[model samples]
Target: MPRSQAETPENETNSHAQKALSLDPWEAAYLRFETPEEEIQKFIGRLNRLGAPQWPRDAEIVELFCGRGNGLIALQRLGFTRIEGVDLSPRLLAQFKGSAKCTVADCRRLPFTDRSKDILIVQGGLHHLPALPGDLDQTFSEMQRALRKDGRVMFVEPWRTPFLTFVHLISEIPAVRRISRKMDAFASMTEYEIRTYEQWLGQPELIKKIARAHFVPVHEHVGWGKWNFVGTPR
Candidate 1:
């Protein structure tokens, strides 16, 4: 019998996902193998083109699911001040102590008041959302609610086309599949499921949801390096 979406085995106890975040294996592999100089330059170049620094230098910026403070650290170097980083990993947050104010929490239930931020940045966070069978729309609404009017949310997502192809190739690799299964087994919440979590993820529908939340797209750029989706609160 063919597997049904409703019958798909849950990997809420995956240990690898519990170790940090439920990272796209492709992105995780690239992060593990590629040089930071190459990745950072590629990221910054695209953001620079998109006017990612449009938020005032003194404005409060929040980096949701900011792992190890990489984005926050880099943004600080670029003149951003009063930055806050939030994530679920205590180990990751602990390493960021003194570098920035790091909060360990879930993005789905952000602990900030409405209209609390000037610029909200979410890098590879939303894909982690639809992984489970819970309230995705509500979570997006919460994110929208947290942003002040005129606030912007920037996301770097794997283009859906490429993500599908990547998943197909990786599923053929035995070792990778084995490791993925083990990780899925150790996950504690549906949030950590790696396979179904990654399948068919994209930004267009998400952009539409953002629109419903009273935001409008400022840009959608598919560059040689990465795809960026930027939206401003209405």
Candidate 2:
């Protein structure tokens, strides 16, 4: 996405915020390597592991930071008919192939009415937010506002696990990058997200604390460089 011309200090701030919150050009380009079929199956596996099979198929669902709508397609395949997606990147949203409604909007400021949504899902997105507790708090608050009393929220994000630490340590080695195609790709992706990724990984405990403050936990798993959390509005 092109940055808006900064006519004033406020515009500069908005530009910075947009940079921090949305995928950069290179990151968006990397997404093209991900096939729709593969992404759908990958999301299906994640949802099943997160207990999505128990969720009401008819419930209204919105996915924040939904890039290319693979997760939305996965939801449809799982029998969900009422689904929508919100993201800041029009370029990524344009790649969506499914029937779900897609909206270009910031996740911290959702467009849905109060208590109107039945579920919200976010995958691999929150780490992009630069502001730590404040941005996280605002996003969760917005989530609560959009969710019904019984509504649930689910997310999968990077965590600072031992394996991840080790991976990052060795990912810097020239030999590893040249020898492993997967590692090479991973390194390229992480290079684009290094700033925000470091910020988010440094506060894993705080992230969990903030999440728990807004929602009653239904399920949570932290390991293998990923944090998967499921909860209902408090």
Candidate 3:
């Protein structure tokens, strides 16, 4: 039998998108990467609105592909103490916040019961998943399934803009690379980062279309060098 649409790798991504498929050791090392503290605060502030009227202090929240559970800490500060994180990397999970639970798993196949979670946060993780053409839908399906009737997802990913595209390209110049190496943040490139970023171009728009087909968009944000979405399952 032919593979189901969910199982097939669609002609979804172009040749350049091939980069989002897998991660190497250095790229794997990159997964344990730290998220800026201010980003965490922003997520909390968004949630404050997301949870408006009632804070949902007891809501069970989870971050898919969470690295080091930095986001879990943000939820804690907002009084949502029942938070969890899931990722494929044990190394990242090991560094998760003290009270948050961490699980090693794929976002396409979450272990949670149907409609068990209240909120889902995907900070900087949306673009790094399976880059194959048809794979993005599977991830979206799982995200919707894991949510309660009112469950929602918030996503923040690096934006694919011409200026940033030029920036990444110029940063690759040998002279620029040498100078960047002097500064730790841009000191080196991860094979994984390079590949997925190439595939991520134009994804924010595509994600919005797919999200609206199955869910409703509470907000669609694009700017600040990134794209963010607050979506609720339909």
* lDDT, each prediction: 0.64, 0.88, 0.69
* Alpha carbon deviation, residue 229, candidate 1 (Å): 1.4
lDDT for model 3: 0.69
RMSD, each candidate, Å? 11.8, 8.9, 13.0
Clashes (candidate 2)? 0
The lDDT ranking, best first, is 2, 3, 1
Q: Can you give the TM-score per candidate against the true fold?
A: 0.67, 0.85, 0.74
Number of the predicted model whose lDDT against the real structure is largest: 2
- Candidate ranking under TM-score, highest first, comes to 2, 3, 1
Off by over 4 Å in 2: 1-24, 175-181
lDDT of 3 by residue, 167-228 (tens): 66675577776555322233243344667666776566676677687678887767746776
lDDT of 1 by residue, 1-234 (tens): 888554555544354455436554443442343244544565566557667666688877888877656777667777787889988766656545336688999888888999988877776666555543344565567678899887887777555566545555555566674667533332322233455445524445654555446557788676432457678776
The most accurate candidate by TM-score is: 2
Candidate no. 1 TM-score: 0.67
Query: Which stretches of model 1 miss by more than 4 angstroms?
Result: 1-39, 130-134, 162-193, 199-207, 210-214, 223-227
Cα deviation at 132, candidate 3, in Å, is 3.5
Q: Give one digit per residue, the lDDT tens place, for model 2 in 6-56.
A: 667788888766754586655543564466787899899999999888888
